[model samples]
Target: MTGGGWRRTLPLMPASIPSASRENKKKIPYAWELVGWLWLAYFMNQADRQLYSVVQKQVQEALGLTDIQTGLVNTVLIAAMAVMMPIAGFLGDRLSRRRIILWSLLAWSVATMLTGFTGGLVSLIVIRSLATAVGEAFFVPAATALIGQYHVKTRGQALAFYQTAQYFGAVSCGAAGGWIAGQYGWKHSFWLFGGVGVVLVALMWRRLKDAPKTAAAIACSEPIGDVLRALFRTPTALVLTLALGCSTFVNMGCLAWAPTYLQLEPFNLTPARAGFFSMFYYQLFSFAGVLLGGRVSDKIVGRRPAFRVELSGVSLLLCVPTLYLMGATSTLWVVYAMLGAFGFFRGLYDSNIYASLFDVTAPRYHSSATGLMVGFSFAVGSLAPLALGAIKQSYALHTGISLLGVVYIIGSLALFIAARGFFPSDFLRNQQTVPTSPKL
Candidate 1:
């Protein structure tokens, strides 16, 4: 694809790729604009997910649901998202991503709005778990692949900035959703956030433009089996996927339970205050970590392709102690400090998840590859809520949460091994297999 129109210029290509790429210097600004749009989209995506947890307590009491039932609901939603990832990823590769993203936003937003109207657990499962999951599942693969396609030169930083939306959405919505639930009702909170998502959809429809379909992209678009085989054959990809699974397990459990944990026992904060404290300090420092990690990775990856993996390893290791401390400490200030440190390192690890995946996988398989990675991670993570809920019945929340440190330690080791052994070969292999030109 030419570097004109909505398509941005390709950066350094593999030595084996053809050198006849079209040179257009124009679309650079548009790339950043695309990032901006994605930032909003991702914000909505995360905020919508957090809505359930933010008001889960109220919903549980209103519906006379058990903790296990609440966990089941979270599991169903995450499982549905996992199940849809491959299909969504496949479509993202062949279809218009812009259109896919637009429709996804519309579908999930509508579901979120409709969630307010639910009268029972069955309806909540139908709307929030099944429908919402199906809609939201289509977003990440297409959106992240689009960013990877355009912002190749500034990919790390761009993606990092895009990820900050997660922190923003989670932290802000955690507080806002709790306040809304308390002031109005949990139902109105859903309505408010869902309405905001719908507005963003209109904005995206007007501003977001698709890149021109190019011959190289068409030629490179391989069958689903081929894409899967190519990605899975690489040891680095396998290791990375497993590591992500471990990370997701910790993340999903912590995010789903943190506020609830804070509301109980030693820190008995109210819903709004609990939500605020749960996400505020942790995500606040995390935002800085992501930006810093991205900038550092981009600047250093040339000389050290293993930089991303190493960073992830170190971050995960750091997170292990912080996570454990957050649970073990009875002192609220100590818990807060540990959580802040945990968030910072977690962000550092998260900033390169997709970037590291792209480093090994071919450009042609970006969407599908992302789908598989995300699908696997979420599928494993889906079990966390249920497991944690069950554990909470028999043990303290702190005990269950501290177990997450083990998962982080395992993931850290796996990544360290990948960096030392598999990364260089996988990185080289992907570069050689794909076209040099950036496809719009």
Candidate 2:
């Protein structure tokens, strides 16, 4: 879906959208000079997002918090992100996504550094919950939207590579955070992470350009409220949002509990070891899943276009069975394989969450819509951890896994329905292509 050849998004910009100026088109697809910095930024984004989770054991013991309490704390963070998204989404539309992303990265890093200074529960909650989510709220929506802007022909593939950095960053950080906790202490990790973000922000500010807006968008600018209303009204957007919410629900639940689960009876691993390994396995598989899913989605979408979404539904179907197996298993290797399989299935849906959205939304609203999804889905999904944690605290890990498996089934159904009914068709929308490709 690059800048040239013959690209049509919808009723908005029907004339064929060409590749970028010959110079851009001529650049190698993975031209390090062009996309390297953005990739680095993506890696950092995941590092920060998952770093705290990686160190959950140390934090829990040191602070003397409950599973539900920690879950509640994370909930606060997600909620903040959710609440900020609509406003940020709106800003991303009217303002600059690149600037918003840079600022967001900077803000969260500062909050991360502040996290190291806290001595008690309240302070940790404030730093990790409010400040962290608030800062992150702006980063993903804007950054992803920005990525989608540049890569069109290979939108699925490009976004996949870009998003792969997130998995790598997180997997690296989760392992690093464990080692840091084991050696220098988690406090130092926070300080170092914060500094790295500050540096990245400075670099991005100089490089990123605003998404190229179409002449039609500028000429036929819709009222902001009207845009918002229309966006919410889009059947595909609504369905995609709910479908994503379900995926996030499973992800959050599994992430929050998997470490603790590993630390339990059969595994009996040390806190640091369990934490590292738990994250290590899932993310390892998730990386492969994401990359493959992106490639698969590209091929499928190229053929059916509706398969852009239907494939995800299929993945969701696969996910439920494996997730059930993941939860019910007691054997370490079995669990690992199941977790990997789950991640693989999940990758298909994760990659398509926004591809489906990009199919329906206007170019100007792309960032805004992305923000809304980032904020709301993340926020809503935050509850999964809290719920699972409470269930673990009350009953057994088995119970929670079983419950989560049920949730996956429900979410899978939603995706199936969306694929069948809500997938936006080029036939129904206009001839113009969505100006922005999808951000993963």
Best by TM-score: 1
Give all TM-scores, in the order shown: 0.93, 0.89
List, residue by residue over 1-440, the lDDT tens digit for candidate 2.
22233233323221223334533765553323335667787788778777777777777888898887777877777777789877777776667666777788889989988998988789988898889888877766666666665555566876777767766776778677778877888787888888898888887777666545554233225677787786777777776777777778888778777777888888887757776777676777777877887888777665465666677777777887777777788888888888777777777667777667777776567777887777767866888878887888888876777567666667667767766675544314523533333321
User: Candidate 2, which segments miss by more than 4 Å at Cα?
Assistant: 1-35, 216-221, 424-427, 430-440
**lDDT of each structure?**
0.86, 0.71
Best model per lDDT: 1
Candidate 2 lDDT for residue 145: 66
lDDT of 1 by residue, 101-135 (tens): 99999899999999999988899999999999999
Model 1, TM vs. native: 0.93
Which 10 consecutive residues of model 1 have the lowest summed lDDT?
Answer: 1-10
Give the CA lDDT, 0 to 100, for residue 173 in model 2: 80
Candidate 1 runs further than 4 Å off: 1-28, 219-221, 438-440
